[model samples]
Target: MAGSKTATLYRMVMPDHLCPSGLKAKWLLEREGYTVEDHPLRTREETEAFKAKHEVSYTPQAWIGDKRIGGYTELRKHFGRKQLEKGETTYRPVIALFTMTLLMALAAAWVATGEPLTILSAEWFVSFSMCVLAFLKVRDVESFSTMFLNYDLLARRWVPYGYIYPFAEGLAGVLMTAKILPWISVPVALFIGTVGAVSVIKAVYIDKRAIKCACVGGDSNVPLGFVSLTENLFMIGMGLWMGFNAFA
Candidate 1:
């Protein structure tokens, strides 16, 4: 099918700049089993002339048997891919964070106890996840605070709480992970987690005001909903379990 089917691709490859979209388009065409006729406009004048002739503003155009296909995005659509939209909420960031943390936790358990599936692994997973999430928020506190103000009840009331939240989470995570200073860690985690859970519930479930989640970070496209609620619940549960071990 590759050699039999053919595609004509026009892309830009200037002395100073190369078009990434052109490379992506070529890769997609080849992946879809099409033999490609690549035409690269190596100079500014050539690129402009090519564009003027085609009556198109963008490069990396494709043609299949005399039928003109647009740029990389259009090519993706031609192959039946869901077109990506700006500001689309996705769980990919949280999913990736959790997946990486789980693996790290398992590795830690294996190193500590000579087994991967120990009780300590679960604890490590949650703590590691919390630490990473906190780091993301703290990386850009100003941005996170602005987004957090959108739905967090406490942050809305006291703006400083938004800035403080990340450090508090990181502190609790560090103390919990090290299994030291449980008295401080447990209370901190419990208070923040409880507040977060209530705020998420009120905003998403009760009020139904759709917004972005500041859980992963300020710049993420993760939605303010179930995933955020689950993160808060995890922190709450971790706090309770640790408290029982320390106090009860």
Candidate 2:
């Protein structure tokens, strides 16, 4: 026991607030065959004092053989774990949104027409996806526009376009869902979809910039790529389909 590996961990363990990362660090140390000297700063005052004393920005600190290991992220890095790297993003959010939208479309169609699966389910899926994406943008319009403007040609040219884009998307989506005037929704969807598609292709493929996508909202980790292009293409297809159906 005396000759075993040893580490010291300082983490929060207050009645009101316990540090999850600290517990994780402790577990990681134990898992790695290290005996940890656990220290709990139980109160806000104690935590502040500890931070000041250590001159560190964050807590859940660890020390092994006189070498200080930082917080959770640092711990992962120490173990050679690949954390979220620069320009590294995920499409999980977009995939989740699309999955949920598809389910919703199917559910709604089944409830209305008593057919669980139908051709019209595709329409519902597109419309619902538009609504969901617009809602997410609405959550942080400024952030969304900042990301949008990164690649959107129109938004870059006309600053107000960024502001109007989300509203346009939401309005078109709602109108489509209500089976309202295709006169409005069709054109709106087509124009925006075309512009967005072009912008995405130009930025991602042409310029070869690995940037975050604003499709599912501003705060997304989804990278600008084929998924983004697909979304725009689907919107175009939906708009065209609806428009043709209106006259035919």
Candidate 3:
């Protein structure tokens, strides 16, 4: 069946410009083990003529035998793929932010104590990551709150908790960063983290509901699973550590 499959890709590749979506369409067809008949619409006239001939409004048109597949997005759908035009979410944003926060913590630690990595660097990493996550939540609290309400037990019980959660996180992060008032910071982090972990567990494991996590706020695409659960667990650990160190 693979050997019998053939695809035709008509794309725009001009002297000064190449249509990215067009290039992507061609790659997709070739990657799928299809014999691709590549056609370049190099000029405005050629592109218009092709579009008119195929009754298409777009340049990146694909054809499998006699079937016309639309653009890059349409071709992905045709091939049974769930992805963004660029790509699907793989917790990349969360990973990038956390990695950068860790680096920042190391840099700050190096400046203060002449050491790049130390026990304190972990503390800084948690605090800085919390601040960044809080910012994502606060950016669109309405959206974040809406997504949170879907699975957060407390948010469902008390709608205002959704609105206040971001502020509470930011406050805890700020306090943690300054290493001041451990009493306030520890409890805040502990309370929120516990609730969040429980909510994620119940939603994802117990109820087996697939849902979007509001970890990075309302605009997030992060799924409720290992990564989200780990985030809450980290907070719980941080809160306990800070509390122990504060009195110890």
| Tens digits of lDDT, candidate 3, 1-248 | 55568998888999988999988888888788898888898999999998898788887888898988888999999999976644234687789989999999999999988998898788999999989989999999999999999999999999999999999888998899899999999999999999999999999999999877888878777777888888788889989999999988
What local lDDT score does residue 111 receive in model 2, on the 0 to 100 scale?
A: 94
Candidate 1: 10-residue stretch with minimal lDDT: 77-86
Q: Distance from true position, residue 120, model 2, in Å?
A: 2.8
TM-score of each: 0.93, 0.78, 0.71
Off by more than 4 A, model 3: 1-53, 59-89
What's the lDDT for residue 65 in model 3?
A: 88
Full candidate order by lDDT, most accurate first: 1, 2, 3
Per-model clash counts, in order, read 0, 0, 1
lDDT of 2 by residue, 159-194 (tens): 889989989999889988888899999999999999
Pairs in steric clash, model 2: none
Arranged by TM-score with the best first, the candidates are 1, 2, 3
lDDT of 1 by residue, 157-206 (tens): 99999999999999999999999999999999999999999999999999
| Inter-residue clash pairs, candidate 3 | 144-218
| lDDT (Cα) of model 3 | 0.89
Best by lDDT: 1
